[model samples]
Target: MNRDQMEGNWKQFTGKAKEQWGKLTDDDLDTVAGKREQLEGKIQERYGKTKDEAKQEVDNWFDRNGW
Candidate 1:
């Protein structure tokens, strides 16, 4: 889903996000709160990935989840 839609459905996505990025703590997800940039930043922080790579991974996750 788009950012707004994702935010609106944040609770629903939390479990899936945690499943996908198991290294992320609940605090990290809470900080993200469904913001794409925040999620990307968290991914980068937790995975040591480049910014673009994190963004791509998020995009791919969204696509796979039919969001």
Candidate 2:
């Protein structure tokens, strides 16, 4: 999903986000609050991923979820 769409539908997507990245806590996702850059940073922090890797994974997740 695009940035606005994500921000608007963040509540709906949070469950899927948790499913996709179980290491991330609800508080972490809440802090991200559907901001793509923040989501990438959180993923990197929780998963020990590089920035590009986190971005790529988020992109892939978006595709998989058809968001």
Candidate 3:
């Protein structure tokens, strides 16, 4: 899925994000408020991942079955 799709499907995406980044708390996802960039920023802040790395991980989740 593309960035737009990710934003549009934020509820699902955030759940997947939490599952992928187990370190991320529900509060962090809520604080990001479904904004893709903010979510990425939060992910980086929480996980110490580079922007591209986080984006790649999110995209990989999207491509995965049952995500």
Candidate 4:
């Protein structure tokens, strides 16, 4: 899914995000809600990953699963 779709479907997607990264909090999900930039930023902040890395990870999951 693209960023807009992901944002629109965040309620469903957040569960997947949490399943992937158990360390992520509800606040993190809330912060990232409906914003691709915010999602990448929060993932980077929480996971200590580079921005590109975080985006790639999210993108990869989306592509791999055809979500």
Question: What residue pairs are clashing in model 3?
Answer: none
Candidate lDDT scores, in order, read 0.93, 0.94, 0.74, 0.82
**1-67, model 2: which lDDT tens digit per residue?**
6799999999999999999999999999999999999999999999999999999999999998888
Best lDDT among the predictions, by candidate number:
2
Worst 10 residues of 2 by lDDT: 1-10
The TM-score of candidate 3 is 0.68
Task: Report the poorest 10 consecutive residues by lDDT, candidate 3.
Answer: 58-67
Model 3 ranges off by over 4 Å = 1-9, 65-67
Model 3, 1-67: lDDT tens digits are 5556656777866766777788888998887766767877877888899999878776676578443
Name the runs in model 1 displaced over 4 angstroms: none
lDDT: the better of candidates 1 and 3: 1
Q: What is the clash count for each candidate, in the order shown? A: 1, 0, 0, 0
TM-score per prediction, in order, is: 0.96, 0.96, 0.68, 0.82
TM-score of 4: 0.82
In order of lDDT, best first, we have: 2, 1, 4, 3
TM-score, predicted candidate 2 vs. hidden true structure: 0.96
